[model samples]
Target: MLLPMSTAIAQRISLENHLSLETLRSGAGGEHHFNGMCQAACIASLLCEAGYGTAREGLFGEAERVLLDCRRAGIETENWRFDGKSYRILAEVLTLHDKQLSITPVRELIRANERLKTS
Candidate 1:
């Protein structure tokens, strides 16, 4: 059986992983990754608008950083691709929240990318 703390950690990791996936998607060209990252950022922004303090700080903050990082890396929004390790790291960070909003769409975006790869 998993301890409560361990379970929480696991959840936190999952969230970060998803967020990283969002970042990768944002970078993948012809793959809708950037759009997906933007969508996730919007979701996080909405949470901030709703006054979820931690969510606003953590999620939205991370989203902003991801955007900035992409820019710094010279990764254009129009030509981005998923980086699996980065996705896992971001998902870990995202999992720290107790709430479960804005994650599903991100997951969908990842799935969509997977589909594209297979097709």
Candidate 2:
């Protein structure tokens, strides 16, 4: 499916400004990392809901990795889920950021989530 031009451009900009591992590691903290992971899972879940299996798989893989990192750092993340499926937030974030997939739906999903939160 073709994404909106503005969304595509925004994705490109995000890719250009992608975060580095060093930056992520340096800023790693309990709440920040957890939030990042949640963001990743939300993105992946959106892509999966939109029928983008390949993108979903990639994002899910990344989320798993991030969760592993959380575990290594002695942070607990045992309750996150997507449609009854358990997920690690950090790994999801990595998967959601994969360059091979477009993140337009992910952005929309996030916005929807925000609306839901406020409503």
> Which model scores highest in TM-score?
2
- Cα lDDT tens digits, model 2, 13-84, are 345323422234444334444455445455545555665445534656555565555545544444322221
True-structure lDDT of candidate 2? 0.46
* Candidate 2 segments whose C-alpha is farther than 4 A from its true place: 1-9, 12-17, 20-22, 26-30, 56-62, 68-119
Kindly report which residue pairs in candidate 2 clash with one another.
37-89, 37-90, 40-93, 59-95, 62-91, 63-91, 63-92, 64-91, 66-91
lDDT per residue (tens digit) for residues 1-119 in model 1: 21123445546644654654665656534334444444445543543444432442465566566656655454444445545544543453344333433233344334444554574
C-alpha lDDT of all candidate models, in order: 0.47, 0.46
* TM-score versus the correct structure, for each prediction: 0.39, 0.42
- After the best TM-score superposition of candidate 2, give how far the Cα of residue 8 lies from its true spot, in angstroms: 7.7
Candidate topping lDDT: 1
Instruction: Please give the range of 10 consecutive residues that has the lowest summed lDDT in model 2.
Output: 79-88
Candidate 2's displacement at residue 30, Å, is 6.2
Candidate 1 Cα errors over 4 Å, as ranges: 1-31, 56-59, 71-89, 92-98, 102-119
